[model samples]
Target: MSDVTVPPAPEGLPYVSVVVPVHNDTARLRLCLQALAAQDYPADRFEVWVVDNNSDDDPRPALPEDERFQLLRERRRGSYAARNRALPHARGEVFAFTDSDCLPHPDWLSSGVRALLREPRPDAVGGAIRIFFDHGTVPTSGPEHFEAINEFRQRKYVEEWSFAATANLFVDAPVLSRLGGFDATLQSGGDLDFGTRLGRAGGRLIYDDDTVVDHPARSTWRELGRKTVRVANGIADRSAHLGRRDALARAVNEGSGAVTIWLKVWRRNEPAPRRAVEKVRYAAAFAYVRLLRTGVHLGRFTRGR
Candidate 1:
């Protein structure tokens, strides 16, 4: 997208700065804003920053003209790029990040801020995420869906294995500035890379089980494919940057493992077999592209013209 740049922090700091990066999804974006507005935290203590990532849709009409919210648009393509655009404008001691589609519980801000504040200068803190789905249209309690959603819940909150997603993570300005902010080059794995760097730099990462947000699963086959492709590209880009042979191998193995689990679900049970099969096929194709991209990326990296 664009080169990574960090601007000077705003003059005065607030209690917490909530940043939500949005593209063109106005409807879902509105829902997320509504959830934030309903937060239990005192409205005067927190400010919301919405970064519009080059949306073709004119979002002004969708947004209510208000002083509490600031809408900034970046012409860049990636969410990380847009995050950089908004980072300079943040005036909170701790910056809380979430996607436009994610909905937070009323206590999300209070709990998350408390988690970060309670720690002895932790670099970042992450909360739990639950999938929210439309009732009757799809069963949220389905085994496959529930398992996928609960995967994060089952993870140990140990410091050694501490990794946080940007969707539910809060970071201090010092750590963010030290880490040079999220890598704008990464398509999807920037969050993991940032966490890894923070870990390497002796930055403490914590997981707070009490803090939670609702992230929705992809509802349609098209969205599932799009997400898979982006994820594969991220793996390829990450492997290339690291210049490690095993990185690509691990990506392939993990990608295949996902396929195998989906296949078992499709063959053994899913009520919608056709849709399941289609998703599996799309995932396989995405995995194959990742493999191919790895090869091409390695070649370019090695040549280094």
Candidate 2:
């Protein structure tokens, strides 16, 4: 079937397990739950699994008292680990992954499942994500602007790198089991690693621009800083199996390239000075992330020295 509006079927629909991993971000998680609850998909065909990854406070109370939603906790302290905790318990033909802070479209599940059920079925599907700001029409802060230009380019990631962010990804349940699920050691970029493995295993991956979700942008420098550190550390962890030096070099180069990439794709038609200001904001954020990555690699390399 082509990418068209998929209608709800009365019977023969496959079961779906929607998995989410959340930390202390309760406010946004509430919205995410509401979105899931409002899905157009039949309740009996889909189940929601919200795995709390050792939040500072138990998120059980946050979960609505509904049988369709189950509360699972993973003390291992990572989103991927929390997801793994739900893997064995997930009783579905398809596994849908989304972030705790994401507001998936009402048709998200139906569209994803429809794509998977096509004649030449895909092993995985990467959906579209729209980055949203809490206040103002445009980004109000440096972090928000930086994220606006850099984050949630899921389309580019899927088409160029053959990987999809877990914020809106769907995969056949058996494919995940065959690949041994996500690498639990990674705190970030787990989606990329998992998707790359799928590609290498000759698994068919599809990019569906119609399947959509909304993710809130980071509004504060501190929030962006924390994310930068987490991602950099994840890169360090992944480099342990692959050569650390090579990965570290790649990270450094990617950071430098981010500056140029932003300039080329950003508002170029604007007055030169205004465009320059935007470039500065993007450069500052990219520099901070680069420095954090360097520190992480140095720390990992000099462990006992």
Candidate 3:
């Protein structure tokens, strides 16, 4: 397939619009753009939009000079907010979302479009995310890795997921508009919140392994810990909006999972006792977040007045 050239959008919207939010990371951004440009999907059937979220290093020059591709600028710091801004400008039946850090397979867009066009017309579709790590890095493992392992193990849940990751997810434009786009306040779990709302509203979400992306898990243990904290914050922020009964159930499940992780850490054989200690510390950090749901609920109750 020839590189997808930017052409004037036809008289009507196309089948798919690939929307990406980019900030900094010019190198990875360039790679992402190039991969999109090389997509095997029919040029006219799909479009690409990159919302540059106030990045100091611009990534336009690296992309093809085709007009079919749009490089817009938004000063917002939040990825979901940037996505909201771009949605109004999109002209496609389906909205496909992915992150700038991910590199999609050539058939990704084609596969996603096909999945949505399935007999019943799935309301949403998600592709698998395979993690790649830097070579020669210390072979040490951390709590975050274990959590990510859980996520990987749960990838099958995507076929029937109430939550979806924006990194490799797609949705029908009308349904997305009805949901009011992505939630702006969430720093990390906005995708999950969006998917949950859609699913609860009778939308169908399907997982397609054929459409895949390469996700590089860069950053050290400290960075991973910080990320876990941000994820916990997102959970807290979205708890009330998730409905009271659901929120309570989720809190209980998270608490149980945390305990299970700690027990596993204690029982596992470790060459050094410090490894066990570190796991306990990380597990506690996550457990404390399980209890933070009370604060989130209190805030919601006070705001209801």
> TM-score winner among the candidates?
2
lDDT of each: 0.69, 0.82, 0.70
Give the per-residue lDDT of model 2 (tens digit) for 1-305: 11222344479788888999999988888889989999998888888899999898767766777898998889897899899988888887889999999999999999999888887989999999999887956776667777887788998999998999999999998898899999897888899899889989999888898899998899887889899889877777766766656665655675565555456535557322255576667666666666666666666656621
- Steric clashes per prediction: 0, 0, 2
Cα lDDT tens digits for candidate 1, 52-146: 99887765655545577889988878899888887788777678988888888899988887888773757788888776555543434333343
| Tens-digit per-residue lDDT, 1-305, candidate 3 | 11333354455334677888988877897788788888988777777888988888977876678776888787767788878877877777788999898899898888877778788778888878877655532223443343444444326657555666788988888889889898876677788788788888998888878778877664355555556556665765656566656655655666676566566656656221256555665555445444454444444445541
In terms of lDDT, the best-performing candidate is: 2
Check candidate 2 and list the clashing pairs. none
Supply candidate 2's per-residue lDDT for 191: 91
Better of 2 and 3 by lDDT: 2
Query: Which runs in model 3 stand beyond 4 Å of their true positions?
Result: 1-14, 136-144, 152-161, 240-262, 266-305
For candidate 3, which ten residues in a row score worst on lDDT? 136-145
lDDT value for candidate 2?
0.82
Model 2: runs farther than 4 Å from truth? 1-10, 241-276
Q: Global CA lDDT of candidate 3, please?
A: 0.70
